[model samples]
Target: MSQAPASFSAVTPYRPSDAGRSLMVNDKHRQILDGLREISQESSSRGYHAKAVTSAVDGLRGCAFPVNSYLKDGNPNRRCIVYPDFEIEFEVGSYYGGPQTDVSIVDIRIFRSETKTNTRAALWNVTHTENESGSEWKRSRDPESQLKPTPKCSGTENDSIKIGINGFCKNIDHAISMLPSHITRGNETSLGKLKSSGYQLFYIPQSNSYFRAGWSFVRDLGRTSPSDLKSSQILASHMREAHENGLFIEWTSHRGGSKPLTQAMKLLAKQGVNVAGKQKVFLSDHTSSHFEADRARRAIGMNTTDSKWHNSTKGIAQLVGGQIFGGASLACSINELINHTKREELGGKIAVIGSTAIGGGIAINSTYEKIGKLIAEHGVSPALALSVLSVIGKTAIVGVAAASIPSLNENYHNGPQDPIKNLGNKIGKKLIPQG
Candidate 1:
């Protein structure tokens, strides 16, 4: 990692006032930003600006949150991660030139202790708009248009707690102007109260020449503090957990060799997360047209011989089978219903419907078994797979019961039938086949 350039010391500190609270950029944060800019510039020179900047931030000491799990879009220029106190947003430029190539801190808003009637009390707030002229940079200035929060920061109950609100606005002025009335209205309104009331907002500076925005929440942050481990270790643990839980993991790596993949698999095996013959792993590499993923597979195999890792062929086959069987069962049920509607005796109609539903249930159960096998084959624990399938199976049974009971009732009361004694005989013959 590159050190912050010495010349960055000459840059003036940014200070902004909110109500009576004054926020200033301290030396440590300045140095961190300066270091980030140095990394960004070096990366931009090599035409790898976005990935390099994000990688630097992800590895920064003290910022140990697992960013990859939440962000899976494979976008190169933007990334966001939330921390307990604050969140960080990175907007990387596409090309090198002028302000487009420059990496600068755009805005920072800190929640401060509230006093008196005014709700807006900023512990730290600064906005830098000197680079606002960059061609790629655009921010919404119309308060009316901007009042409707960004989709990512819409202040919904669950979202406010998990991800909070971090997005872009033209400047601090525009951001303040766009604050929902409820946020700007309360007295003695602390961050905790605002959070409880479900009004959370964070803004990214629009001055930098970057457009795309991506953000993700860390659900496990409470369970495992990022401060406990280095960022790399945190990331590795996240990857292992994702694989063990049957989640699809994807990340962009600029490294030149297969050592990363080999080592990762070895770590997984060491942690007992990868079990041979019990799970299958799939590797995908889009780095080159020569199919480097094949090479990676061989490397992983060499390193972790006991781990079962292979292609997606078996998974695809199981998925196809499940779909085919599920469709066939649905079609058969509908067809049986039609045939039952045509029956002359109400008892016979009800019996045929009952038999058809039982057959459909059997078919659905078989489909669930195939799906469970597919899940288990792909590294998920059998218990987890069975639990999931069990839920689906129970739901299916309830649905079948609900549909059948209504039809039986309607047919029994509404349709004409023979004498009561003959009805039993009619239904018995329809339900059971005789030689």
Candidate 2:
């Protein structure tokens, strides 16, 4: 390996414990590294060297400090170790128009940090550049300034340490600056507050599948007034939990172009990341693409095509409709019972009302249960099924009520009279003609 910079010579070589190695090899870590490799190779082929470098560095940042703590099996108490001006070699298949077997010596900064419960073993890559003026802290952002010619690997096969380029940052200060303002702006005394803030790195998993992982800065946006802070904090907490549980993904806001979000989603899908039906994704209201995102997510196979707002509205409508239908049915049933048994005794009236109520309740409950099962097992549209079944149920309820009215009237009027005998007597009197 190339000699460490004079300023970093005092830094010791990184050696992770066995526990750390296990943490590093977890699925999340491997997916991140694999994604970075994909980004590097693809972006380099397209001559987007700066993009490749920056994206790789950003991927590294995703594995750092408190962010890693949120990752699966990470140690929250582990301290961060920074290796400044570290050098490593990368074998590239192609570089600009260089030879196929060219090797590149890349100067990277490495950081070792722990997850929540175990030390993470992965080495993070960062790159720093000094301008022509040679100021230590000053770095150029120019794309051309970031490129370097290929060089042979300095370390031999016998070297104990082997490093690959996963990601890099310009410097430690740059990394700190990239953090959300809430954490970085607070004073040392607010360290506890910072720790409790629940800020962590989350990536768009779909983007990762396409080799271009998109990251978001997730924290309670402190831009609001103090009055809104509590609710904002709660929302932030829920969002963080959702992301950590793989139930949600978020996309960065798109600034311009009509339907840019849709186009971007399409591009992602075309690039081999399945965007449909995988996990719930959050689109900022600022983008005004809520409808667009839903359409894209559905077209791309996302789990649900409806927005939360849309679903909520549908639910409210269904609830209101059900209530109105139930109230009307109850009123009609009561009115029918009262009118049909006007001459019946009080005890008989009470019996009829109680029996009718019990039967109606049982029937409604059974119908709803059956409908629910059908929707769950057969992939039925809930709205359609409920609407159709509800109409059928209401009709059946009214029919049962109306059918019982005649029997109830005959049985409870004066005495238990036989309807067939009464009909025969009336017919006999008509035939005898008052003889």
Candidate 3:
């Protein structure tokens, strides 16, 4: 254990009260401390002095405050507190097990402060800088070691061709010109021809695997505005179309819920649309003007009868214990977000989506009317092939469903031909980089 700073030694050591500990119910405070200790050790091995890591973790412990005061558990930055010289940030959640057994840890950042001449600086120096061997490590001055300055990409022609290393080009000619001659003018898919023809195609340095149905789509439905109302019309129409197409459509609304959106949905429902059976429309209560955070959450959507809303951050949580039909299996937690968003080089969301079998159905069914056109328009690649396969599998399910009628498979083709071969070639090119 390290000594507290002389100036702040009088400050009480931060420890959760019995009630606060009960909040986690399973001891998250210890978990956070353990995680920080492990991270500190790893950081030390990489170069940071162990003393600094210890001091930072200790300082973080000292900074802990009762979370009940804010009542904003959903806020990603809720646990974070910033001071004039330093900042401390962390994440809190128990996403897996019972919601009551969740945990909080300094997942974002711990104590990080600027060094200045003063008592604080002296305390920091004594606590963090000094090594057990009585030596100090200095930052390297080598230009190569330092981060390279971002290149300025200004002006039209140059910007169209090459902005920055991570920049994208709007001008199709410039985009194609940047690609290799073999790929650009080759007998690839429409996407490849587009490049050769000098059509606009934005450059994406990194590709995310969880393409659709990921965290990117999981947006917070906050207070509605004029734009939202207008968008609701579009949404209603889309929902109506999905209903006619016999696709399941479910939506949950918070922030007092939308009346106009509701009305639009009601109108569609009355017009022989199956609005409530397979899909559903979940609603929270109206947002109250005068109420505490917990009460507000209750007024909106949380069922206080369950006793879960009292401790829930901001009142919103997985509805009906994350039931597949009504409740979401995943909550709006950092861990859940990571599962949906995190992408690897070759696999990750891609593999997960492909493996699920649902993604394939979605891909094929989504483009049932325009599969060939899509392949022609977008260049065939490994990713596209996977998408096509997903579509095919989904189509097979639909075919099974429409087997009684048999007309459903009338326009559908037997198997993919040219596009599959083209995708293989593209994959080969990627596997064996052409120097």
* Top lDDT model: 1
Which stretches in model 1 have alpha-carbon errors above 4 Å?
A: 1-7, 10-294, 297-304, 311-435
- Residue pairs with backbone atoms closer than 3 Å in model 3 (clashes): 94-102, 172-199, 172-200, 285-300, 360-390, 360-391, 361-394, 364-391
lDDT of 2 by residue, 1-435 (tens): 233333333332121231111122224334443554566566453335324433433333222322211111253222221211111222122222322122222233322122111122111222323478762322122212121111221122221111111111232233222322222222345333323321222111011211121111112221222222222222222223333443433222211111233443543444344433433443322213456656655654554643441211111122223331333344454454345533223222322322333334545555455434443333334444344344434533443222112221111111112222232233323332221
Local distance difference test scores for all models: 0.30, 0.29, 0.29
State the lDDT of candidate 3 residue by residue for 1-435, as single tens digits: 233223322322134442221122123445554455566566443233333333443443333442211123477534543221233344334333332322333332332222122111101100012467763212111111111112221212222111101012222222223322212222247323323222111122111222221121123234334433433333344444434444433233322222333533543433444433423433222221223333322322322342321111111011111111232121232133234432222222222222222322333334332332332232334444355445333433342211111111111111222122233233434442233
Give per-residue CA lDDT, model 1, range 281-355, as digits (tens). 222111122243344333333223424222111111222234323333444543443443332332343332223
How accurate locally is residue 194 in candidate 1, as Cα lDDT from 0 to 100? 35
- The 10 consecutive residues of candidate 2 with the worst lDDT sum are 159-168
TM-scores, all models, native as reference:
0.17, 0.20, 0.17
Per-residue lDDT of 404 in model 2: 19
Model 1 sits at a Cα RMSD from the real structure of 22.9
